[model samples]
Target: MPFAHAVMHEENGVFGISFPDFPGCTTGADSEEEAIRKADEVLTFHVAGMLEDGEVLPVRRSLKELLSDPEAKEGLAKGVLFLARYELPRKSVRINISMDETLIEAIDRAAEHANQSRSGFLADAARQRIRDLLKAE
Candidate 1:
């Protein structure tokens, strides 16, 4: 999970949002609630673009550290603080794996029934197993 501190405020009746750690990343809405929701969508897209560009995502900073920045200090002076959390997945990669022929055939049949490729089916299964194991821990 990665998070960015956000500041929400209104000027001329339009709500504005800002992410201190992400200087140029900003968005707004007509209401505070919509502003918060839009922030999540915007941040997710921003982070995805950063990833595509081979740039590291901005690290979250403490409120104190954020305030130390002149722009953040000025931008958030009259704003309410909130956090935007994101769980982003990396780009998929193909990998070689060994499985029993019988199991592979079964998997292929299951994948066809589910209307998914064998690789896609296996990836979905692996992801679900990971989630289940983590929950059991």
Candidate 2:
């Protein structure tokens, strides 16, 4: 299944890569080929963590619909195409938690390394922990 999203643009001498659906997910390279190569690595970890959590994947919007929206022009320019076959809807829930500063900092570092925002990282961590708990039961 398709497991990642990427958008690219040429600015100055470098190609900037960004993942639209994934906040804080970004990587850049000197060329299109190099950027795509790096994107593969970034996507692997992002999808792996999701798989571990049994989390559903993101849906791919239709090209027609996307194109109709002016906002989507930028994504189209960057070659952002969603493969419909890989689309999977996700379920969301709200929760509250309290943790130590050290732990929070660690999570933040982990999130940065994974190219995800703090919220995404915490959600992934929580999901994985819950999955492990269920498996152990």
Candidate 3:
């Protein structure tokens, strides 16, 4: 995966990280390095979840491009701004799940066979688990 652009700054005595491509995704830490680490984790999870469910990742704008946008400026002024490459596939759904690792592994393998990433496979597994639970209840 490519390194997503991370905007780092200090706020309220802590470091803040934001991705311009993904709105509503932000994190803070006590230091710049920590902030970047948190940003990397957050981006990975966000991208993985999005890919699992097949959701479109919004294209991110470069810092220079963002600075030219009035809306972007307003967001930055409000202490929120960031961007990343479209990291995952796009889809939409809602589900509940409670499954063990064995089941999860099975789904993962199936997804791999289908050429889908683990996230995508686990998403389907979650859906199935939910359906089974509902049927049982």
Those runs of model 2 whose alpha carbons end farther than 4 Å from true positions after fitting are 1-5, 52-54, 68-71, 78-137
Order candidates by lDDT, high to low: 1, 3, 2
Clashes of each: 0, 0, 10
Per-candidate TM-scores read: 0.63, 0.47, 0.52
Model 1 agreement with the true structure over 20-110: per-residue lDDT tens digits: 8877777888878778877876776667657745998877888898889888888778898899876686778888889999999999999
Please identify model 1 stretches exceeding 4 Å from their true place. 90-137
Local distance difference test values of all predictions, in order: 0.80, 0.63, 0.65
lDDT, model 1, position 136? 38
List the pairs of residues colliding in candidate 3: 19-82, 19-83, 20-82, 20-83, 21-83, 54-90, 54-91, 55-90, 55-91, 56-90
What are the runs in model 3 whose C-alpha is more than 4 Å off? 75-137
lDDT (tens digit, per residue) of candidate 2 on 1-137 = 56544677778878766665555656677878777766665555555566667876555455565567565567668664532112232575677889999999999999999999888888777656754543333
Q: Tell me which residue pairs clash in candidate 1.
A: none
Predicted structure with the largest TM-score when compared to the true one: 1
TM-score of 3: 0.52
TM-score of candidate 2 to 2 decimals: 0.47
